[model samples]
Target: MGQVPDLPIRNFEVAGQGPAPPVILVRSMHNLLNDAAQRALRYLDELDARSVAPSAEAVAGLSRFQEPLPETSMEPRDVLALLDQIGSPATVATAGSRFFGFVTGGVLPATLAANWLAAAWDQNASMVVLSPVGAALEDVVLAWLRQLFHLPAGSGGALVTGGTMANFTGIAAARHALLNGVGWDVEAQGLFGAPPITVIVGEEVHVSMLKALGLAGLGRERVVRVPADSQGRMRADKLPKLAGPTLICTQAGNVNSGAFDPVGEICARAHEAGAWVHVDGAFGLWAAAARERKHLVEGVELADSWATDCHKWLNVPHDSGIALVRDEQHLVGAIRSTAAYLVHGEQREPHHHTPEASRRARGIEVWAALRSLGRSGLEDMIERTCRHASRFAQGLRAAGYEILNNVVLNQVLVSFGDDETTRRVIAAIQQDGTCWCGGTVWHGRAVMRISVSSWATRDEDVDRSLAAMIRCARSLGVVKNNS
Candidate 1:
């Protein structure tokens, strides 16, 4: 080998290199995080006192965020101040007790704390080698969920982003398993020449499930729609003969009516016909944890796969969903990845069970939620929320408003006189800002949907919200009395 000559050092003066620019010692990140924690606590402390809907001024102030990005970095404290001042007020206060627009659950304190700690850890829950704690927590949470939901022993599951992705994950597994059974390798060969799978869903199937089916290479429009009764339960008798690679997607919770399909019959028939069954139990599957409501989800254990949102009914922080499959190999086969650089551990690798390769350690919050709220506490929260929903239904019915659904769970649909009048009442209630509820058209009637999913929602909160709703309706002349 030839010897290389030493490189000469440049003698030219570098620009602005005088005195090495005194090493600036910035404050520790702990101070900034503490500042954020204080601000967050203050905001949460005032959540109940604030309006469920943002005021006109706060809505108008959203323009403050529209400015061009700054060229230079700003102090973290200043950035936090700006966000708390301008951004916080414009929020809809969905974490508060009175906001009932969607089936949104307020963050449990333990879950919130766990979320902060997990963010600080900054673990990428991709592989066990990447984050052993994340993977272990995920495995523990999955086992706890299976136990709580009475799922089959040794079932496989993944933590997903939310209900939509959860549904997508389970459906992806279903597609893989069904196709693979028919001598097709979906993951390897793609859906190009694969056998067409028959998808059956109720007429009132949620839009999220349909979107998930579409994302899984299954045509949404190709589904066979089973008729739903007045309460939105799928008529089991209406199910057509199942054959070939078939999938039956059943709903555990109807968004409008909070009704459950005849899942027992559906699963039995589908299983007998060698069909894969998946349940979209976004908010309703938690009913299995409640002793009084467990009957509503009877036979859910027989389903091949299930999807539900921990953020909705479990009262965890936003963006937590669970996808469960009876056969663990199916989920692994559908979503497992391979690379020479990747580490495969003896234990569970989180990414192999989910659709994402890299994701936050959401399982930490889920574990915190389950650990903090134990079995009885969780059951109480579910039962309490259902009671609140029933109270709302009773109050609205007493006030002469039409209760659209049987108060089966924590969802109530109410209508004023006519579509126009109901819409006006809904608008008036939102504008009044005492509490916030959303409008939805159910069965050709414009109705207000109240979803009582938050643990923070107390009986007094329900009464106050009911009073405000009735007052608004009376103000709009949609209701006969202020009662």
Candidate 2:
């Protein structure tokens, strides 16, 4: 095909007559930073007193950002002022004590402060040469995480954006190891004409797992589907007959019911049949860190690879996930990139272990999270949130409502009568704005999910949210007189 005709370039817009920003680095930087910090502290300080959800007027004020790009740069302090004034009002208080819409945690004070400091450092984190501290912190934290999760001493991992990328990274390594066993260099030759690898998953597998499989060029629908039990756990007995180049994907935590698959049983059976088992633990993986909750993930250590989110139960911050593999070489083999100009030092390059090269120093915040919490503090956070979930279930059941799940972890699924009534009650609760909890469909019926994943969520916050939920249900006729 011939090329299309060329078009004329548009003329540049006229520049505004305004003062240019300062070119020199000066002590005034601290003034701008102090102003921004004060604004952020004020916003956070008001979270408990204000409504959890933004008001309609606050959301509508987002239109202030719709104007055309400025021809001249505004002062940094002025820009920060506009952001705090207009942007802060429209944000959902996920960082507060009452946001239960998802299985994600509020940032710990240490991690949040580390994030701010790391942003100022502006480390690329691609290689040890570029950011030695960043790479060193990754090595140290990966070790700490391995011990925390009770993984094998030899296991290693890399940080990613979230659970989806974590799953993709682990699954990609599994693909590489499994396909390479039969003399197929899948990475070098591509999947074309490669050996067919059998993939298996349960009925209640999260969509993120399917997305990860699809991203790895493994057909999402091509895998065999196993049946799950009433609690949304994969029945190990129902696993299909395993044969040649097989990969079995298991869930450590069910998104809705908070039920964990029989990972130990499945691993034993899969290993006997010469198949690889991978766990998509996401948030539930953190249960291993709590002494009382470790039994829930008994066989989790036996998996070939695992994916989890530090942002969820670990209470670090948003967009922090990890992909750990028993053999570090497998992960490096799947994701490592090489270039003549790139620096290859004696130290392990952070980029070699994950799917990105040019990323922020995420490991810094994670290091701060672990260092500040230590072992006991983390365990306390996990156990405390789980107890809060049980409290929610108890309060709702006492009000003549149904508690669908067993309340095993930090998740609770409550059904306020029929599907229509459940949906209506959920809407009214959102409007009430006392707390934020999202709705989900569980096993076939509509239900609301209360995920107490944040370190900020206290016993009193749970009590307040429970009261609001019951009141909302009573308003919608789902409950009579809240009795």
Candidate 3:
């Protein structure tokens, strides 16, 4: 009786005129919305309840659906209902503190909520004219990131999809700068007639660099793999003498181990040789802001360009990467494109700087994340994560497991007994669900990689994960009781 007569909810349609059209629209929306929200909420609650390890079975199960979606059988609502029906009972908690596989970061409440807001707004971040909020936010956040990392004052930044795309943008800019020096326009003129551009990369560099090169018209074989030290850092002394267009790609964070390259030395050499220096700091660049780990990334600011993922170390959501370029013109020149329908604004337009023309308001979540953490919060997170990694490695070593990596930052590589024992232990740990770690081949031997990147991770989480790993190792037949 208290409801208004002109209420908009009363006019909503729930069905089609003929055959109910399978009740696809309303049923799909209702089922999916309800199920998805339920699953998300439950995952969060379960993480809160279980401090150590969360099962990734639900996620892994979804991975099985790689084929095309089935049509006509089930509506979106029905699927949502099914998801709720199935996922409601799932107790997997990897999104919590104990999941260490990959560079997984636990979603901060602020970041998560802001991400939801970003989805709701759905503002395109490409052009300033289209979404002033997004463009302005990116401009503000870029400056903040520069200050946060203590980079050069005048450096420019772009928000990309992730580490891979960030690497692509940074390298592309490097390519453009190198070619431009010799009176060549890469974006305007294709790589067809251009002179050979030598791309030098560390042997331990991530695969994204190779993929980026391929995407930028340079084949993977064209890249020269520079040797790395035992710790997987670029060998600065062995840098080849270059005469022509050259781009030297360096790694700030080695994927297997958390070792850092001598970036200052590499930058100096690359600069002297007139080569564009690009740092692929996928998960390690943020270490510059951590007081304890800052020394490891001492020469990061000196680089011509750097790529890092906010999603990895910063503990933000997926697909958030930041690329910093010292030369603003090169960054802008490489990615900026003009369209007849798009009007140019005199102000700082986000689209003019990045590769994408129409993009989501990615800066909103990033801004929210930065604002929530501030400098001290971020430094605390970095310090805590590193400490946890050390704790994990120490516990395993105490249990007679072989510690592979130097454990410099937040990544720890360990082996159980032998390669087979180690493989079995890794499998048991993954199946045990106390924590999740991936296996990697280090110097011909398989090793477990424990990456600590989540904000939700605490000391207790580390202890629990370590216990699980040790138990799994002991369960392996090769692990001797005396040893």
Best by lDDT: 1
Q: Write the per-residue lDDT of candidate 3 for residues 378-479, one digit (tens) a residue.
A: 999999999999998888787777888899999999977678878888888888777789999887889999999988888888887777777777676646
lDDT of 1: 0.90
| Candidate 1 Cα deviation (angstroms), residue 79 | 1.1
Which should have the higher lDDT, number 1 or number 3? Answer: 1
**Residue-level lDDT tens digits of model 1 in 230-279:** 98898999999999999999989998889998888889999999999999
> Which lDDT tens digits does candidate 2 get at residues 71-141?
97677778889999999989899899999987869989999999989989999999999999999999999
Model 3 alpha-carbon miss at residue 64, Å: 11
Give me the runs in candidate 2 sitting further than 4 Å from their true place.
Answer: 1-24, 480-483
Q: What TM-score do all the candidates reach, one by one?
A: 0.94, 0.94, 0.88
Report lDDT (CA) for all predictions. 0.90, 0.89, 0.81
Worst 10 residues of 1 by lDDT: 19-28
**Residue 170 alpha-carbon offset, candidate 3, angstroms:** 0.4
- What's each prediction's clash count? 0, 0, 7
